[model samples]
Target: MPRLKKTVFFAALITFATLLSIFCKMENRSNAELVKTDFDQQLASFQDAIEKKLLKAVLQRNEKEIKQSFLQTRAKYKRLEYYIEYFFPSTSALLNGAPIDEIELGENLIEQPTGFQVMEGIIYEQPTKENRAELLNEVKKMQLNLQRMSRFNEQYQITDAQLFDAMRLEIFRITSLGITGFDTPDALQSIPETASALRGIADVIAIYEPASTDKTVSSAIAYLDKQPNFNNFDRLTFITDYLDPISKYISSLRLARKIPTVASGSALHDDAISMFQTNAFNVDKFVGNSTQFINNDKVALGKALFNDAVLSNGANRSCTSCHHQSLAFTDGLSKATGISKGEPLLRNTPTLTYAGLQRGFFYDLKAGTLEDQALDVVHQKQEMNGSLTQAAAKINSSKTYFSLFQKAYEDKSGKADAWKIQHALASYIRSLAPFNSRFDRYMRGDKKQLNADEKKGFNLFMGKAKCGSCHFAPLFNGTQAPLFSKSEAEVLGVPSTTDTIKPKIDQDLGRYALYAYPQYKYSFKTSTLRNIKKTAPYMHNGVYKNLTQVMDFYNRGGGIGLGIPVENQTLSADRLNLSKLEIEQIIAFLGTLDDLP
Candidate 1:
């Protein structure tokens, strides 16, 4: 009896020891560390595939094999992009940024394009001997980029907060940029790539999520699985039912876990909230040198100058002459009139509200900053028709203006010069950022703010209507969501008139006139949809008189569907085929964007 009791005691002790050891091991390997390990392995595999498959296919001049390899390479990259893009932005840009020359901020140096997009443009087109050399060079560059990312993954440490933030932003990125075919413009593989990206995110989330959250992940995958093709994909249903819910669940988990905000200098900052969140977007993010321009005194002085007719050459019209506050800062004319009656301006007067959020200014995107934009408007031939130099002199001529300028620029050593005048005007415009709209309020947890029809409209705008893909969320502007780094321009192929008879592509050669890029022909800066209800006579040319007309044009697939010859139309020629009810719902949502008094 004594020997049997001793044996039982020893056996129980051994079992306890083994269980404790396993617990210790599990505790040591955190979810974040495990996620990193998984990410590293995927990235390494992608790099290997690129070298073995992509490089060889390109060099051998095997078009069929090259296409197949490129698809695989792109898919692998998309899977890892959620982490890579957030942690190492410059490398990601080198790997997959648009094949266009982009001027660096502050430095004003233009960066020549490289990587996947550059290669896509080359390999997808008819490959010539000359193009083959370019393709080889681009492939080598991509290999180098991959090596850089691999090195970054080795040293970079990711926290739980960053992982959650990255996952959410990835959803936003896929929703806004991915499904819209923004990156894979030629291949049109956005749908498949998006599915791959979502799966990648799901795999990572599954590592940490509890059993209760499993349904969210499964539902998202189910939605993606149900889609027969890219065209048939119900974007609205996916956003409303799956993506948004999953994001919310993850966000809740993040909060419940008490995870810290993402570290600064990463792709997303701690303050960077999702687009769906109300009162979260900071307008100062868009304001270049915000500290220099965001002063209250500056805004006040700018408001005074905005209403001062002396800013115009004839002194008969101020900024308010074309932009009335009553009409949501729009003139309500088809095209703005010059100081001299009967003389029309170059384009319709776009609203000042949320205009400052855009990276580029004007229909042609000629102005790089709001200060430059203000200067251009001041000196335009038929608009303000006043030089900044003359405007400064005129402002100084008045005692009231002199005192206001003195107050506004009190911190500056120099007097109110043309530069200060431009800055002040830009400051006032920047203050009009869209943060207090009905939609914004609703998003901030006011459940009763949006009605059933309005909510449906919101879904349609984001989903089937394809508006959110271009307009984007939160700001509902061209400034890309998650990171409002740059605004985008689209070639909608808008016609001169809504006339069905002998429809003609507008003669205005939009951004093409500015930079002369073949791709930019008929391309106009994507403007804000905020206050669309009030800002009538839409489009740069003001061809569409109402929202219904505009919706119908988009439903019919812009100029291409109208039987107009627009070879360079950036908007997809695929008809949206939205019903009347859907169109009305979208319009109702647009109404919610209007700022309350």
Candidate 2:
């Protein structure tokens, strides 16, 4: 009788535990549903506001009304940016992408950008009938795009993991793109938009942790609201004291909620505490999956091969001949010297510092991988003029190389092979990305590393100077942040020489040689400005002798402002109107980017 009573009691206890588990799961599901429903409603409201206010203002030629309506629409769009950008990026591009021509590389198709940026360019200009017609067309497109986005929200289900992931990325976007005035070049309304973006994230946070108030996010929003001026905004303080802390808080909240991070194969790792942290990026994501596992053995082998003259045709020159480690892996020459005496290479030798972080390798962005780049250089007549397969045979004959290969591959019969050589060399390049520059240290809480001038320079670079728009923070490279999937090429209309008058464009066709696309003309891959202090004679053609000349060129608005006839100049032609002192300050900031040895 006692046993029977015990069995009944135990069974009842088990049943109660299971019911509690189900209830907890159901509650979590309900939270996700609630968040999604709120987002959907917000998106619908944003679309309606645009259709009624912005579209009407454009039609009536009311400039004042148009600007006001656009600003309101921008705030609403920012609220939905996190989900829309993550879930429906293609649609998001149509609604609010950069006002540039996006070319589908393989398909050879051009996608003309149409969105808020396009509308801003038109509205900020004279309110002519032709401009109104163009603005009207973009407004109608946005209306349809928003409608299509609404349909996706209705059908698509959201998960707790995705919601958290999207929010974190949005935080990154605000720091990298939003505050930098990347999307609001003409409008300059990024500060308020950033506040709206934070509010959206705050709303979702409230749903998950209702009892806990996010003081960090609230503080940031308050600061932004109080000082909304673009030029006077303290971006450095905002990033360090507020945005970074808010991101960390969100990460902590997600952890406390026991939400799993979605496995997104982005350059920015999911486990990164802050975007400015050393381990924030995953260099492996930039390479092929097969070669991602880089060990010390591979790096050692690569280092040796990089210095050995045996890899060259006549066993005379190696990579170090052009790429000097003391000079940030760059030769202090206007152009790289060829293997044959007096025969120079077509382009300048770019620094190999942090080279592996990019999707594209060369100036023209013709090579997809570092391994491919290594192979190309080895086979090029002007460079190495040595076959990797042949080089492998040479290495195989050497007993020293045989042992190194055996240990690297963990195979008894391991021999030097072409693919292994390429991987090893690429591995060495990847290991070069040591995120330990003075600027990096400053960003990671070492406040004393940067002085007042450097700080102001950083603000200018990120804000008024428009340098951060291309040279993104953390990496300071062309790889767009929050995604870091693609490398951008810009047509700067680089002159052949430093001639202020009659500035003739460099004859090099750049990417146009590879694709023949009109848009690709004069387009060179945006190189990393991390070690800009050491890598002198800037530009693909090595046109500028010093950073001062480069600054002057940009200040005057690139080649076009110098009277160069460039129809497809990607750089803004309008003068930066920077004072000499401001230019000096920017240079001082660039000096801080040199990596620590």
Candidate 3:
């Protein structure tokens, strides 16, 4: 009996010890997970800072702050790879009852919706090599977007700031933070806080009053009629011209490059910031900070710099020389001359009027975003004849330019690149978006109604003429779709009214050149019909001189003259042919699109 009792006691002790050991291991793991969660929360704080910087730069044109902020922000992207490395294994361990360090392998990665993946789409951490490609693409996108927004924010003030914040936060949440990788049902779901912030950004920016920023300049502009020696410039022209004189600088005769020796950032004082605060305690200071976006002095500097030969390679032409506002972005020519050769540019210079309505830019549609376009144009031998390296060197040399860059891009480095200048130009172009056209007013029902002629013209446009199918409305640039729509090109049979034989089909295939698709022979991007009357000699080749003449050609299912026989013509042939007065009405309606916002 004594022997039996002793053996039972030993067995019990062994059982108890084993169970205790298991429990201790489990407790330690739980604590580690808690630490991870805390770390993740801290990471989120840094992420938010990046989002704010990117958004502020894009929307508010806070070039200076946004510049450094963006560089720092993008530089942090490489660090995000750790997210996948750290979190995925832990998440898997929790779900599968494995050790926390056990890695989640193979296809257990995140996926964004088709368009939102990679460069243009959502971002994610932790992935297979395939998934890493997507993340890399997204990083590139952030880099591009940061640069572009940095440039463009200057044109629009406080309201634009709000918009930028919303866009940045929304993008960050969807790409960087959202559950784009897990098989969990709600992995892709957005956090409530982030979602709410996005709505708030839009609402705030929408209500921002631009008057605050331009109040000083507006006063000056209003008083311009009362000023003396004003006869040298027109009323509208003079107010526009005011930008150049205020920000004065010297340009080089041959290269037109800006040479700056000093630098200063504009009025960023605490009291001034407080003054911009609205009636409510709006924390973002959306209203109060509105004026921070613009500096008449900087704008004036930028404006004069735009026309000055000092910035150009050859010094013979300026941005205005190519993009004639009077001619509506186009120089009234299919292609313009550069310093290189008399040979025409590869494509027609489209109007700057409504160019801002787009996400991706350029006729080729190769640029993923606006900043890409801005940067490319400067570097192109046929374009601005400037390099980012050279631009930064030249601008940093200028004392005033350094200050302008600091105010605009927040650094001497920002001035070093062409981004700040390009974005400023883009903002100016975007501001050219005027939506108050007579036809637009009639459509919105602000006016009584379109007359019978215009009504008939509208019907024809929507109906037989079928112009709106490609040349869509509201923006009238390309087809109207939700966000991220591809720019469309058409193979219009535009025979040279100037010459007999039409240009070869392969010669002017717009998108085909980009994609090298044989199908898109002779296709060209559908330009905004807004201000079409102002830009004459239509088509990619400037084949037609007037709307009536172009319409007549389209009426015949492309040129009756010699050309690659019009196959796959968008316009139907010989069907709903129109009368003369009908043509006049349609022309009148098109004319309505001419007066830009």
Candidate 4:
């Protein structure tokens, strides 16, 4: 109880705490080192398999053996995918990303994709000498990428938080990409590969917590090991029953161990346990700046600003001129009408519902943030023809607007700036994402929210219909899942009209207008299918008036299948062969995505 004795006791306690912190760090490093060793071994095995089995099989013209060896090599690659993707993402892309020409907006360079997706397409095709040589070259390039990953891994320090985060993301990858055949489009080996991916996560988990029981993981892996046909994989059941539970389990384990959640900004909330949950995504993470955050005051201010024609210069048009919240924030028109009477805007008025979730805005994917999007629309001649600078001045003149601005921000200058105005409007738009649609309810365990036909339609959309492959679920948009880092654009070869016999490709340059990339010609950012029932007149150009007509276009294989010339169509030209009944069912499922008023 004496002062000296108390000081000595406290000093001992502090020393013990410091030692404990050091021990935890050491343990984390040990686990990470073990994971890295496993990853390096897997990479080496993949390279060896490619060199010893796959290339030789191709050289010998043994089709069966080549496929088998390729599968084995991919299994190895899948095992280390978590770290490779999390730590060295660029290298990971070169090794197994989508086979497309991705444009780096910042660098203004188109990166030619070369990875597993590319190799899968080539290897699955006829083993011609040209194809064989191309595959070999791609394989060699991937090997070099693997070597580069090895170099990076040696210097990389994997934190416990990052390890758990990466593991959870892999589950999302399996559900959204692996099982959907986004990468293995040609081979349809997604089912088996999914099992491999789950096993890989389970293995990593075991290294950290050997006593951990992965019941959901085991169940999911077992289900996938059955290797059902890709077309009839019962993805709805797999996702709701198996994959979702696995993600929760991993998150629970992470929390139980008191490991930190991911600290960096992501489309997903740092502490979200399930991607399907309502609070999974954080719109704030998608903002252009910290100033563009949402609050009750900001939302209310934005709502008033959104409906005010004062921002439209002398055009007398407001955001509500094109977006009506009663109709899921979309104008009920084929194409948006401009300030000029009877003149249509270039693109359809996309719904503001869940607009905050995407990385890109507009049909052409021009703007990077909602704030940027607000600025663009205000300046566009046909849309608003207003300047944010002038609009800010007008807002400052209004006493009502002054009070709203005072409530929303700390600035008492009584002068509205362009960026602040943009941020307030963007914040209001950001608050629009309410993931409480019927489909969302059903996914979250209110089973009665969806009927039998609706359930079947969801399965078809995710599987046979191949809709999920493009419209990644939960958001049902092109925002890439798990990472939720970027939005995707697809060239669907949409026709100018509904006329099937004499179809003509829509002449809209789309994203090509922004970058002039050949692959971007006619490419548009994939719009969210949420609230499709309410937001009618679909597509960027609003080509389809109804969901049935939209289904028919996709059913017949988009514009290319409609006999329209489309060399760069990203959509498959193969007929979906969906029966009329199946189309109805799919439409029913889409109806479930509508949010309750």
lDDT of each structure?
A: 0.80, 0.89, 0.46, 0.85
Question: Which candidate gets the maximum TM-score versus the true structure?
Answer: 2
RMSD of 2: 7.1
- Best by the lDDT measure: 2
Residue-level lDDT of model 3, residues 1-597, one tens digit each, is 699898999889999988889778756653224333433453455456555665554344444554455444432332232222222322212221111111112454333222122211222233345644544444344445434433443342322222222233222222222211111111222122222223222222222322223333233334433442211222222212332221121111101222222111111121111111121011121112342343444455456556655556655657786778788767887667766667687666777776655544666566755446657876777777866556556666777766666766455453545655655554455455556566655543344535656655654554346465456544566733212134565566555444544444435566556664444545566778888888886777676778987776665556423344666453334433667776787787788777644
Give the deviation of candidate 1 from the true structure as CA RMSD: 7.1
10 residues in a row with least lDDT, candidate 2: 264-273
Q: Model 1, 362-473: lDDT tens per residue?
A: 8887888898988888888788788888777766667777778778877433356788888899989988875788887776667678887898887667656677778877
lDDT of model 2, residue 165 = 90
Instruction: Report the Cα lDDT for candidate 2.
Output: 0.89
Show model 3 residue runs off by greater than 4 Å: 1-305, 340-342, 410-416, 448-452, 482-484, 496-506, 559-563, 566-576
Which portions of model 2 miss their true places by more than 4 Å? Answer: 1-29
TM-score of 3: 0.48
TM-score of each: 0.77, 0.94, 0.48, 0.93
- lDDT per residue for candidate 2 within 1-597, as digits (tens), equals 699999999999999999999888767676788898788889879988998999988888888999999999989999889888888988988888989999887787899989999999888988888989999999999988888878877899889999899999999888889999999988899899999999999989988898995588899999999989887687888999999998999899989989999987457888776888977888778887854577899898899899988788888889899999999999988899898787878999999988988989899999999999999999999999998988898888888888888888786976988899999899899899888888889989999999999999999998888889888877788988888988888999899988787679999999999999888899999999998999998999898989999999988888898999899998889888889999999999999999887
- Ten-residue stretch with the least lDDT total in model 3: 246-255
Off by over 4 Å in 1: 1-34, 47-76, 90-148, 151-165, 178-269, 393-403, 412-415, 451-453
The TM-score measured for candidate 1 stands at 0.77
Q: How many backbone clashes does candidate 4 have?
A: 0
Candidate 4 residue 572 Cα shift, in angstroms, is: 1.1
lDDT comparing candidate 1 with the true structure: 0.80
Alpha-carbon RMSD of each model:
7.1, 7.1, 21.1, 8.2
